[model samples]
Target: MVIPVLAIVFTLYFFSTILNSPWTAQVSAFSLGSLLLLFCVIFVAKTVYQLRRGDGTLSFGNIVSRDDLASGRVGLFLATLGFTLLIDYLGFTLTTFLFLLVSMTILARGRGFMRITLVSALMALGGWAVFILAFDTRFPRGWFETTMKAVLANG
Candidate 1:
């Protein structure tokens, strides 16, 4: 309730601040903001409905349990936080690959390597190709991708 309300308020403020931006930037920001707003609206409505039906309380009673904080949850949360901070080093494609692989591995206790590999490859390459082909925006290629490109170009 509170979080979504804040998100909705901040999103509107952000949209106001970006109204003068060019279409390319505005389109991306507008789309993302609209999506976020839509989700927030849905969440708010659901929360209200639950409250009316006496299904759940607004209180976040023990939501962040100590056991969860002490468990692998913390590791998972830290991994996600670090992934965002270090993504530019590996670029979107490779960073996404490693993030999905390691996150899924941790969640599933090391099972589903084949599934994870397939999904991660599809996401990374598909994202790269989409940006390169569609948007004409080749994202930051890390050292590994840069080297491969140079090698391929010379060969």
Candidate 2:
């Protein structure tokens, strides 16, 4: 319930910030934020309904139990945090690739190393192509983007 409420608030705040942005930026932000806000509203409403009917109890214990820590939740959280912190320094594509690789590795319990690496690389490249190349988003430029820009310019 708290998480959903926070999500709603964040989505609204994000929408407010994007008002003066370009149409492409506004469209993408609104599309994703609206869905987040809608889902959060629905979840909060359902939780309230369940509470009123005495069908469910709010338990914060399950949110951070030992099983959750053992199940790679902590690793995923750290990976997400790292992604946010490192994105500016490393740029979007490279940071995204590293984050995905680490996240997939954690989720797979260290299995499928080769496949995870390949998928991560492909996804990072695809994101670069779409967001950086097609949309020309303001993602920070690093080695990969710089090199690609040079190659494309020369070619």
Candidate 3:
């Protein structure tokens, strides 16, 4: 019920933005897609909670009490969004590596720092190498591109 309302509102908002703003259709589509995905998750979570409770209503006590809990994923998501913006300014290889490292660190609880670091680095480096070398795809040239170009010039 609430999810449907929010979804309608978000759709209207996006439609208005597309009509009024100078942003390209792709950008508006992406924004609307994200909003729709968020609503889907919200709907799913609510449904799951209701099913788990065996009641359609979540208790007021549960909502008032558990609202204080800080979900760590919120911070991780904000970091990822920032990293995405950084990609336009810092390039894909560097941003992807840094974003993956930070997100993995945050999500890896009770894990050894050394192990996490090694795994994150290996994954990030291997992904970038494959995309750049094998696929021959061009990524954004961010702030680090000049330095990368210099290094690759020598290689």
Candidate 4:
């Protein structure tokens, strides 16, 4: 159920992007639609497999474990939503770093503040260097727009 739900969500999101893009007029919408449809198919296949394994009597409750609900995984989903809101403003590296740090500490129960700090910093720097710096990727930057423009321009 979770996998199918995520697939549907991601499919909608990708479809949205294709719709919003300036090249939508030039590109074939069918291609994008078909690709997303593939995910839907995969979701159905997995769901059917689960149903068969359950002797045609599937329980939705069993899919998501009680321990998962009790843990801070629910909060992680909320954090993912929040991270998406912040991504445009903070840029991918900073936003991903912050999200990962919060997720690891809260949900994963990772110890050692120093380790988290180090890991987050390294991940942000590496992501920035590789994606934004080396590859010259152009991710949206709401607040850091000017700074990103300058750095990317220099590169």
Clashes of each: 0, 0, 4, 0
Kindly give the stretch of ten consecutive residues in candidate 1 with the minimal lDDT sum: 60-69
What would the per-residue lDDT of candidate 1 be over residues 55-125, giving only the tens digit for each residue?
98876445556666545576678779878987779877788788877777777667889998899888877
* Predicted candidate 4 versus true structure: per-residue lDDT over 8-52, tens digit per residue: 777667777666567755267657667767878887887799788
Candidate whose TM-score is highest: 2
lDDT per residue (tens digit) for residues 15-55 in model 2: 88889989988988899898898888889889999999999
Q: lDDT score, residue 99, model 3?
A: 80
RMSD of 2: 8.9
The whole-model lDDT of each prediction reads 0.79, 0.92, 0.69, 0.73
**Candidate 1 vs. true structure, TM-score:** 0.50
Q: What TM-scores do the predictions have?
A: 0.50, 0.62, 0.56, 0.53
Q: Candidate 2 regions off by >4 Å?
A: 1-60
Error of 4 at 4 (Å): 10
Task: Kindly give the stretch of ten consecutive residues in candidate 2 with the minimal lDDT sum.
Answer: 60-69
Give the C-alpha miss distance for residue 14 in model 2, angstroms. 19
- Measured with C-alpha atoms, the lDDT of residue 15 in candidate 1 is 96
lDDT of 3 at 144: 53
| Candidate 4 local distance difference test against the native | 0.73
Task: Give Cα distance to truth, residue 102, candidate 1, Å.
Answer: 0.8
